[model samples]
Target: MFRHIWIRLKFQNPDKRRPFYEEETRRSIIRKEEEQQWRKKKARRQSETVYDDHEADAGQNDGFTPTEGGPDPLICDVAYYARRVGLDMEEFKVQTEDGFLIDLWHIYDPAEYTPLPPGDRTPLGPSTIPTSPSSPPGPDPETKKKPKYPVLMIHGLLQSAGAYCTNDDASLAFYLCKSGYDVWLGNNRAGFNPQHTLLSYSDPRMWAWNIRQMGVLDLPALAARVLTATGAPKLGLVAHSQGTTQTLVALAKEQRPDLGERISVFCALAPAAYAGPLIGKMYFKFMRLISPAAFRVFFGIHAFIPLMMTMHSLLPGGLYGALGYRVFSFLFGWTDDRWDRGLRDRMFQFSPVYVSAESMRWWLGRECFAKQKCILQTKEEWREEDNQDKVEEEKRSSPDASPAEPESGAGEIDKSESHNHKASTAWYDHRVPPFALWVAGADLLVDGKRLLRRFASGREPHVRVVHQKVIDEYEHLDVIWAVDVVEQVGREVKEVLWATCEGREGWRIPVGCEEVGVWDGKSEGVVGGGKEKEGEGNGSGESEVEEVGRARVRPRSRFGGWFRG
Candidate 1:
């Protein structure tokens, strides 16, 4: 924690001593203006407007006046933030198979789409499967173009769908909506407004799940809702951190492998599969050292740190944001070096949402992911595989060397190897969708590079890596929160989504992606594909601006770079 603080202090600009104070002043003025305009628009709509589809569509862009600065510190609403950016958000309550009601947010251009009425915004039951109307309900097909292809985005741990909306125009959800793709932000079960069909907040059954339930239940429910709402056969899946973890588990053949068939492409940002160096930190180690009963006693079986949520409601937004950042930095070693510091307060408002203690245990307890390191394999299993790889590599490097004679029990060893290979080799089946990974090279929270190498080798034969890149300067959150996130991650994601889209003939192509050709399944190679340049910051308390020139700097050609099949 002290080290992180020192890094922040060391990297400070002497001229910008009052940056936050100045930003607060500017934000206050802009927010007041925006709220006034929004009120006037709302009053006009309420007094003069009836439900007119064409009129709403036509006047959609009229009321939106993009704010000049960061979001308001007082308002934590996603819809309000969306309206400030000339986009609108509609919320839906989607119930998982386990009866937990999760929030799903849709972002759309107000000029292009009509908002759903309040009466139609009720919770969708577990048995409910939305179907398209047999007859046209809105505009005529001949006059109106087809809807944009849907993209479902899931948030990381302890955050709600609002995480994707805090960055204003540069927010991934808004960017994708503006780019002409229908964007749906999915929250995991028990978010800010935890609800259940048959259970109350006090019921332990309401919070008895872990990531397994999230993968097999919550994620599928959200995806189904997005596909059903858009009437698309499949939607692109974009996930960050813990979101990526659940997706990886869901796509595994032993779990909800069938869910992959409904996804066109999986874009994993800061993909979390293998545990990183941060897992060994004191707090995490403490969690790992405790027994399950002790864990339950400490965290409670219901909510994980319910006090955080209480504090979120009690504290002022700026104070909460400041304290939240400090606490998270102490826990995870994240710095806002790459984030838009002006909007950092807004970003924190969407996180530290309601999460179950059981889920936290699965992440950091003595017997689950923290112990295993790799989500699907034990340390011993993966280590054996790594040793085998080393042996094979040595053999290739020395073809002329004599082969060693078989030792006693070699037959038993061969049988063991075959059995272990079958058990640990593949995580996904042929039903899995194409994967495009944006790895944070400097992210100490997850070992994304190891996950990439797992795919690059023939370990997961069923998986096809359509695109891959390593942003050497990025930390875990930078994939979404970074100021240049659009250029570094969003643009590539847009292209990859368009390229890997299987049935694009019927869908409206996203902006900046019209010229992107369908991936021929040949661009599955590493970016740079060489050793890191000497003196580059490896995400270890280095100032991001100092390494800006080296960030995402790919080689000019593949002549000297490596490629994967």
Candidate 2:
């Protein structure tokens, strides 16, 4: 398939063999013509529609209305936005065990200035102290020490650290920093800044990796670096979408339990894994269902969706927002397009950054859907390996087993025991660190609730479910870019961090977390409590399970069972 596309792109199109300037000029002309046609069509639609004063007034107040004099979307990224909002921003580079160099941006609250490094001070506010649930140890009440634990925020696919800072101080990274937490925004390989120590951008080898590399190398390296940089024993992890996927693969399936130990909590916003079949939208389904090779042919090898950047450079500023909204909605599936339209230009500026063709295959390939696993290993392979270990265990435990069997079993068991010890410390098994999962109720791109349920229910006993929620109206992207996200999503995040800081135990929902009026779906009265009303949810874009308790559902099967029966 790629051979065919390459032949057509290179051979059939004579411009491919020509100089770069000529080819680029031709492409720009075509793009400009397309944009002009779109603009004319848009003007025609507006002129055709009969509008009155009341409708006009409503349109002005609607969330999609563009605000004047907004910052240039392209230039105002995470770092730029953080600096603009009176927060202190510092940039650092993290090189993975592999040669990929990841960008890490740290946000600090200007109000809490201290010389004790980044993460050595005590927490601010009377409530933010570091007290163990088992031992009531914390700073004295008179000092009001700043929170020492750092938070590493990882953005989703096709996004940079800019996703968290796009909403200004209302962004999650900024919100955490202001509320007395050291915040670090992490950029994975192939993001806007795809720098590496040894590889050039032109080398396909540089883009030869995917989420697998992120799980095994990038995430751990970044987290360890954050720990070392902050001088803290543990840092909380806040990840969204694909960010959560790699973190889960790293900490759970890959069995790097030490990473879990270093991370105080994992806050997955719109978690992506075990993705349900794309529902309601054929465009989204078609996009996800495309074979990885074909997708590579369409997107090319260097950048996964280079078209966005192309459109940005080719289309005029006034036209890209409309195009960006439509294209993104088609791909990602938005129930309520929550990103402020005012910043639509900026959203396009940094989006659809380069991703390796290999990584694209990982997400959309047969290994993911056929085996019901998203990582490098298939589900059957993982299950078989696990069963082998279990079978060996049964032999060792049986009294009638041979001496030699036990002797060999003893060595294997020791090794297995070490792995099991690491596995025991996983978040799903609830052995050590706590986590909070925020699900976007209407997300059609990935099954956020299923990701939450995998750990929340029908699993081994471990630590508590720190916080579990489904904002009924939000789509895949709204958790990060929504207009009201600061109030609805940001508050819950701060509360969960606060709980971890105060040394609370299992399944503690944040206090005073009433259902926001913005979440007009079924979660009307559920709040910070363990009790949830059980009922089969109707197809009202809401989940059936309660807010807390019950790991009752099994891991989802390959095709069906997106929701528990």
Candidate 3:
């Protein structure tokens, strides 16, 4: 780690770093000015209006305004960050099957939805597996207004749900809420506070879990709570990095396949299905070479690198942010080139959360994922599949090859071949939901393109790829943090959720998506409601949307130009 930091310090240009600092300074000034204006407006409004104390308080929280003291650098709370952007977050504790109480946050607009009181935000226990579709309940039954379609957003590794709330209006959770969705942020077990009903923190059994437990236990618990709270039978599932990994594993037939029935659509950002080239780095190689006992010795059985969390608690926010960025950049090769430099510090505050040493061991230990370079299949299994495919390709390409005369046992041979094909290729079952992928083309952390090929080549026969895109310039984190993410990823995700949504009869249609047709797998325009207008630039380095389809539900204005040069 020291050597990597030294290399960066020696080679990276100081001149290039100056622009990011300058931009952050400018943004800070703008935020202060905006906050001042908001205070003046609030005071004026209070003077003009006459109402009861309760009414006045409600009115005060209704309008859009910056936070009271501008952005707080030290605040790590999701609710606080949500309030900074005129939105509110309500926390609900969800108990997993194993009795771990994880946090689930709901992001709602103050004007549209009333906040649930602290006592009312009750802890939800494990749910029975849902089997049928049902209509969602309204926020207030007296008003007769339909509830927004519920959507659950899961965070990446070492990060909490707060990652989705840091970018203010540009944040994915806030953007989706404004665009008309009931957004819920789901955190895995033992995020910041490790609480359980039975086991104590020091108990080794409490820490004896890996990604499989997360997939089979934590994910389902969160999904169940979101569905029960919204009264919706199914909700759109969005995941990034390790979030996608858990979802992928859970949806597999051998795992908790029943969980997929509760999800309308799965939108994966930077899906980490296959190992990337970075797995071969020297440090990672060393981890792969070490024994499990040695791995436990290096990273204690309780938590992986607990010292990072200690620094997080002890150091000042600004100092921690700077050091955190440098350390993570050295380890993962992440840069703020595509992120908004003004919010870089805020983003780091949510990460480096508590993750188990066993989870890290499963990811990098000698006998697990790192050695096989895959989560599900062994290296030898992959090689055999590749050789079989090569032989099939050779047969297709050879022009001189002739068909042989049928022998007496030809029928038996064909049946055997068909059974082998199905057994070797299929990973998911019929219960799997439709998938929409936004792959980071430049990401070295995971090979999302290879996963895309797996679906496109009919390997996962049950998987339906409703929408797919490769953002050529995006890095692993850019799908959620990029400056233009609202246009490039957010808008598309909004439309996809609406298009593939099931049982939309009583649901509230989101803004800018009224014309989005339900995707029926027959036409290409249903997802975006228009054909791409070739050679027509929209002056934003993007192509404009043109309506062409006759689908029942069509988009009035399409969020096009996702593909960049």
For TM-score, the strongest prediction is: 3
Give a tens-digit lDDT track for model 2, residues 1-565: 4765887876575334432335345434543453454455455557896544343323223122211212243563555566545576766666777777777777764544433454432212111112223432334245555234578898887777777876654567766676556788888886765787788978877888777678767787777667665555566789998898788766653345556766667788988865655633564345457776776777677866666666666776557656766777666655334555445565655566767767766665543542344332345643543454456556666899876545646877665664454344333443346667778887777777655554544343454556677888777887887766766677667655644543332212222322212222222232232221353122234443474344222221232111110
How accurate locally is residue 98 in candidate 2, as Cα lDDT from 0 to 100?
71
Q: Order the candidate numbers by lDDT, best to worst.
A: 3, 1, 2
lDDT of 1: 0.76
Ranking by TM-score: 3, 1, 2
Candidate 2, TM-score vs. the true structure?
0.63
TM-scores for all candidates: the values are: 0.80, 0.63, 0.83
lDDT of each structure? 0.76, 0.58, 0.76
lDDT of 2 at 214: 81
Clashing residue pairs, backbone N/CA/C < 3 A, model 1 = none
**What digit string (tens of lDDT, one per residue) describes model 1 on residues 233-260?**
7789999999998998888887788888
Query: Who is ahead in TM-score, 1 or 3?
Result: 3
Cα RMSD, each candidate: 9.3, 15.2, 8.7
